[model samples]
Target: MKKAYKKVDFPTEKIRKFLEPGPIVLVSSRWEGKENIMTMGWHTVLEFSPSLVGCMITAENHSFDMIEKSGECVINIPTVDLIDEIIGIGNSSGADTDKFNKFGLTAEKASIIKAPLIKECFANYECKLVDKQLLSKYNFFIFEVVKAHVATSSKYPKTVHYLGEGIFMVSGRHIAFPEKFKPENL
Candidate 1:
């Protein structure tokens, strides 16, 4: 017979912190000619060819509604220099205030999407919603990368990693390790 164990429920906040090293992304969406920016931490690459990305936004979030209606969005990858602005955007609501004006974020037109990209970000990916079934059910939006742009500067300043609550980590020096290690006697 199989043994059964009691299930334990972990706190959502703690679980989020454990999933660290996530990129700090500035997500922009436009609807009815109005555009807004929101900071997102729950996002990841899904595919390479015809690149795809998945982002989770709460149903109540204003940006989520806009993106659903517009069918387009821009994901801007930010460096540590924009940490303050990222936090501000994450804490505020686009429905109540103009986040761009409040956070001093500048927007530029995207090549393949109606949504604009953040000018201060290190890189931007213009995407169109490729899948919405998951989004409607779980508030998770999957997009196909239509176009991508990066700053001319080859050197990226420090990057920020979300660690739940008000905590953040800055990117450090790069290090490489051997792909495999062998035992001396083996």
Candidate 2:
């Protein structure tokens, strides 16, 4: 059976919901001894080698000022088990409350960055701001991953994906067919 498609106008406000299934990330930044963490969903990988990451941090976010000043941050990836905490972190503002204390999240020191890592996250990427060309126009800041860490025993950890308007989707089953694709390089 073939399903019929209907044509409808898309709303600009909700365009991101259809264009991308962006992963949820907790960005921790520190500047002049002040540290803060902000939950963000608009991030993408720009390169594999040199590990370039581009994330959008609007000027309104408190972390923006800290990140802009320090040029250092960490992107912490959380599994589905921390869904509630992710939502809480996204809902609250760091300017008003200490998210690390209010959310009961432990801050662990990073090896190469001043920003602290979220102890509960499955993985953490210590990053340094490498470019800011898009900040004025698109609010996108490019970062280079200096150090990376991941859990050793996580067999199938699922992470959360933002679907806009407070809706979320958790990572599910995996299907792999490595032999079907030819590798140019490792």
Candidate 3:
């Protein structure tokens, strides 16, 4: 019923490069009134009805501890203008410096979470952690979006995508494809 295939081995660095171009999300979490922000590339939408998102953070990161304690976080989607700040924040740990203050990024109170949202970001989503078993076992955190705020502007918003290490990429033109393709018939 099922076919078995031989296992293949690929270099970690090469595979990471191949999986580049993922959205760069600025994740903020607060615990015991102390807030921290970090840049994450491994995040994605999980559901639509209740609006859930999944993000993976290394256990060694300070943000991981905060998020685990607070059970909430804010995901900020930044524009291309914040590329330099993103790289700076990503490279440094919040344990040593206040990332928000260092980057001169402004923050506003979130509607549903204690974490503050980055004011300059185009979109912000307040989320509450709904699953922690995954985080404990695999360092994956799943959150349900509680509320969202978006900038009110007509101008196109550009987002930065992380490639690997120090490399970054910007969002390009938008394109849509048909659900079904009829190459031969068309």
lDDT of every predicted structure (CA atoms): 0.74, 0.76, 0.74
Candidate 1 regions exceeding 4 Å error are 1-21, 177-186
What lDDT tens digits, residue by residue, belong to model 2 across residues 24-48? 8899888877778898988977776
Q: Per-residue lDDT for 58-171 in model 1, tens only?
A: 988899889988999987777777777889899899999898788877777777678998877776777889999897788999888777766555444466888897888887
Q: TM-scores of all models?
A: 0.81, 0.86, 0.81
The 10 consecutive residues of candidate 1 with the worst lDDT sum are 1-10
- Residue 118 lDDT in model 3? 79
Off by over 4 Å in 3: 1-21, 177-186
What shift in Å separates residue 43 of candidate 3 from its native position after superposition? 1.0
lDDT per residue, candidate 3, 2-78, as tens digits?
11112122222222121223678899888887888999999766665567777899999999999988999988777
Candidate 3 has its poorest 10 consecutive residues by lDDT at: 1-10
Q: What is the lDDT of residue 133 in candidate 3?
A: 76
